[model samples]
Target: MRTGQQPSGHGFGSPGAAPRATNQNTVLGRAMGKVLAYIALTKPRVIELLLVATIPAMLMADRGNVDLWLVLSTLFGGWMGAASANSLNCVVDADIDKVMKRTAKRPLAREAVPTRNALVFGLALGLASFAWLWWRANLLAGVLVVITIAFYVLIYTMVLKRRTWQNVVWGGAAGCMPVLVGWAAVTGSLSWEPFVLFLIIFFWTPPHTWALAMRYKEDYKAAGVPMLPVIATEEHVTKQILFYSWAMVVTSLILVPAAGLVYAIVALLAGAWFLLLAHQLYRGVRGGAEVKPLKLFLQSNNYLSVLFVGLAIDSVLGLQTISEMFS
Candidate 1:
């Protein structure tokens, strides 16, 4: 009936052996290592990217007149849900992580954490997240949290990821859910504003991810993942990247009706800049030059962050949407 085993030689053990006293420094170091290992399982950087788009969506939903407590709760709940999904993904991808140099240092891949522990931790966090969001935000937000986690884990990680080059295109749906979760947290309902925000991320995900995948093509190949850069020609993949980049830019414009002048200006200007780099990368691919895709990858992150920050600022500034200005 033992769910888990105690550390060996704790109390009951071999004959006549005295229990070893725990060294405080060693204990602290071990505890700290466990903390970091668990943190790695959550992939904090990716969660940060997901969360970057969240609060702004909340601000936009409520028009900057948000409850501080609600915002805090939503942010925390978003982090929890993302953390759960990431942890479960780490566990699922442990085999591939061991093969891919980019992921080899992950805690599970490195054997710093047991798979069972990570699975239990991930599941526990998911249940806790649902309860927290339901109590702190609303039932709608709570339901969205569960749906996102399930989609990310079951669809993206398990089904679509290794099966096709278009995996990110569809699987990225889960990543686009946070804005919905955020908007739902604020209004307890749905609208076009949040859907516009969702599309922005939906189209943004492929290019941002494909850019990184291009850099790690070998890693994906070695790990048997069918990422676009792994199975397709550089020209073909970069072409798709350019296509998605422009698609994302066009989607950003759709938000102008809801987001207003500040966001529109940033969207037009930043979207142009983002496309410039996307085209530049495409050009490098068409020619024989080194594309250095990570540049575009980094820029895409900045582009999304800038757009959302602009939206938050616009809401705070009480800027009117183009639709409103016309009316």
Candidate 2:
């Protein structure tokens, strides 16, 4: 065999050895990076907040013994729908997201995931959510879920997000739908109590999100997004925040009689704390002080979580004294 010729290496040191090992490793790394990027597109933090609105509604509807199956189903469906909406938002805002530091690393903006792939993923999740909700929960709940998804994906993200300063004001209604969905899953119909909870979240969204927007005003301005702080003067934004903060407090307190003394006490304390923070932000904005709105933003999130948790607890406790008042 040609004098037992040494096998010729194809750009490698050994015969039959795999070539381009470095390139192969790079390709593997890139694939793994893309997978992680796709996960990030789901917006886990927003999903968590959405769950916050959902769980309390379920507990309140059940009045104590929440159906484990229903809870699980609602959670799965809500998460799927929320993730789908977030992905759609990313696709829609990819261009502007590239200009914002907070959103610059998003998968679509970073080109880690193809736009068509993201769109497909969102649609798949949304369809799965609808099917799950319809089969496991009431049709009303499923319908509400669909509406919530459409409101966020179409009305808020596509139509309003970049078009006006009041985007969050009106878009907030979309975020409040989880409460209605959860309540409908139990009752299979709409009622006043869940609507009250919806209103609480509707009013709460502004101050909670605006504080964050205030902190990121520069990024939003650079991206040409007309977020409240970007479009309105700081003083005006602060006033708006204060107004919504007061409204949230009032709405939350209304649930006291409709819910219970425990809920009332919790709402009172939480609402006071929320108002204090809002007042501080108002002062900071008025004085043109460089106060960190991030503090208020984070605290607002905690405040809402605690308030809702308290409501769930009160509902489970079932204070007859408080229930009779509504009767």
Candidate 3:
């Protein structure tokens, strides 16, 4: 009859109350941790870049009147698709990832999540993304999202990444899809504007990645991944990085004519600075200096962040000269 006493053989006020609460808390904590891990697996920084590329294409297509709903839908779809692709990459690269310092701690690589569970999660996300895009955005955007996922997961991860130094070159295709998705989400059709933006990102991937690869050449070699630095000499890779960085600057400038005068001026300044950083890397690589590649790698990260910010600024500002030039 006592409030804290158990009835018959039971020891507490409610049968298994304390144990159940403990279990519930444990489960809740685990669920929260898993959710955080899943979010991390989506690579928020990479998604930021993808979104940056997307918004400009949306603005250019709508000519300053981007559809808010469509943009939101496309963003959702893009994030899901990217998360799925990244998850698949983790699953597929588990073995190699374990060997590389850069990826050793990934959920799949470290067995923090079961491979089958990760695969299921990835597939479900991919399907949800497709459905979201088709229903809320447009079929074209949906299809492009699927293609991007397939390209990154199958073409790049399963095949090209292990076989050739040109992995990033071909792999870059997937990275460029958000622009197309953004364009289609706005206009329900593809156009030159998206294509130009796509090309800029496509060319930009190698140098941006190669600089990091140079810093991790030994790890890549140990893992037998055959990244550009692993496949080619330091001098060769550095020169290639410089070449691509220059090309990226030029390609970004193409938007000036298509995007506007504001875009052009921003592109010119950003591109020139990016190229200068690349040139410095080139000189260091030529001189057999290790610090140069790391410096360039960091600079490349800034280059992308700034370039996309500029695109978004131009989009919101609605500079007439740039719009007229593109128009």
List TM-score per model, in order.
0.92, 0.90, 0.89
Q: Write the per-residue lDDT of candidate 1 for residues 78-167, one digit (tens) a residue.
A: 899999999999989999999999999999999999999999999998999999999998999999999999999999999999898889
- lDDT (10s digit) by residue, model 2, range 58-164: 98888867688888889899888888888888888899989999988889888989999999998888888888888898788888888988999899988888899
Note the residue pairs that clash in candidate 2.
Answer: none
On a 0 to 100 scale, what is the lDDT of residue 23 in model 1? Answer: 65
lDDT, model 2:
0.86
Best by TM-score: 1
lDDT, model 1, position 79: 90
Clash pairs for candidate 3: 260-322, 261-322
Per-residue accuracy of model 3 over 1-327 as CA lDDT, tens digit each: 889965674566656577888899999999998887777666676777677788777877776565777777788888999998888887888899899998887787777788898889889999998999999887988999999999999999999999999999998899989999988988889878788889888888998889889889999999999898987888898788878887888888777765656677778888899888877777876777665577777777787777777777677677675546555
| Model 2 stretches with alpha carbons more than 4 Å out | 1-31, 321-327
Model 1 superposed RMSD (Cα): 7.9
Q: Is candidate 1 or candidate 2 better by lDDT?
A: 1
Candidate 3 lDDT for residue 260 = 56
Estimate the Cα RMSD of every predicted model relative to the unseen true structure: 7.9, 3.9, 3.8
